[model samples]
Target: MNQLSIFLAAGGGKGGEMQLLMMGAIILVFWLFMIRPQAKKAKQQKQFINDMKKGDRVVTIAGIHGTINKINDDGTLELQTSPGSYLKIERSAISLEWSQQINKAAATTVTPTK
Candidate 1:
């Protein structure tokens, strides 16, 4: 036991530096797996919202489906749910994934006339 304690004490000087290196690695892994993807997604969402225009079909985070009738200057959208039914919602309420899925499906289902 005396020899084991002396061995451990002699090697203790490098342990703090190893711990700091491990901590840095953990932080790098966490940022790559968690923070980086979230920030990229937020940037994509912002771009999607900015690209909105009249007549673009979209789905809201609340699951409301509509076509944009008007782009308001105050960060809001005038959504037309039906021929005459309209709802005013914030631009950020649009779901990028849902809207893209819906639009992609619509594009593929269109039958071209000869």
Candidate 2:
């Protein structure tokens, strides 16, 4: 009765191959647009986390901002919120992009020539 019914009626011998090709195409496009980029971003994030060092300013996904005071051997970080005030947090909680953006913005906002 509908367009789908009409299409199904018309598609007899070649319909199975067409459906398989279309499904394969859909999967390819989905991986190209979605899965691949997400995996790449995850790899970059892991690299960023591994590269972090003491005295580096960073922000967490929870919106906490601090400076790295110490790198623990147990996959955790000691963050200094202020002088003599420290908080221990997991390394994975750090947000690489937010920290970089904030630090860059802070750097740009200050007029060095002044």
Candidate 3:
């Protein structure tokens, strides 16, 4: 009957709408929980690279430690390990900053005295 066909069509349309809504919600949740955090981390990395300056001590990704002697405009760093030792490294090779404040806080928390 014509009414039966109309009823089936309407039901199918409603199911399709629900499926679309569910897919959209899943994509939104994936972006929020996964993609957004990665984007934020990349932005932070860009800011850190831009803020680099001479005299800042840095640790390279290859586990080399040195003080920044000069910063080149083309994303290169001249590092001084000692009086006469120097090396050129790409800006991305530097990892997070090393700070004495973190060491002091960690030392205080692990005191042997009761």
Model 1: per-residue Cα lDDT over 6-108, one tens digit each: 9999999899889999999999999999999999999999999999999999999999999999999999989999999999999999999999999999999
lDDT of 2 by residue, 59-92 (tens): 9999999999999999999999989999999999
- Model 3 TM-score (2 dp): 0.72
- Which ranges of candidate 1 are over 4 A from the true structure? 1-5
TM-score-better candidate, 1 vs 3: 1
lDDT rank order: 1, 2, 3
Q: Which regions of candidate 2 are displaced past 4 Å? A: 1-11
lDDT of each: 0.97, 0.94, 0.82
- Please give each candidate's TM-score: 0.92, 0.86, 0.72
TM-score, cand. 1 vs. native: 0.92
Q: Give the best candidate by TM-score.
A: 1
Shift of residue 107 alpha carbon in model 1, Å: 0.6
lDDT of 3 at 102: 38
In model 2, residue pairs whose N, Cα or C atoms come closer than 3 Å (at least 3 residues apart or on different chains), thus clashing, are none
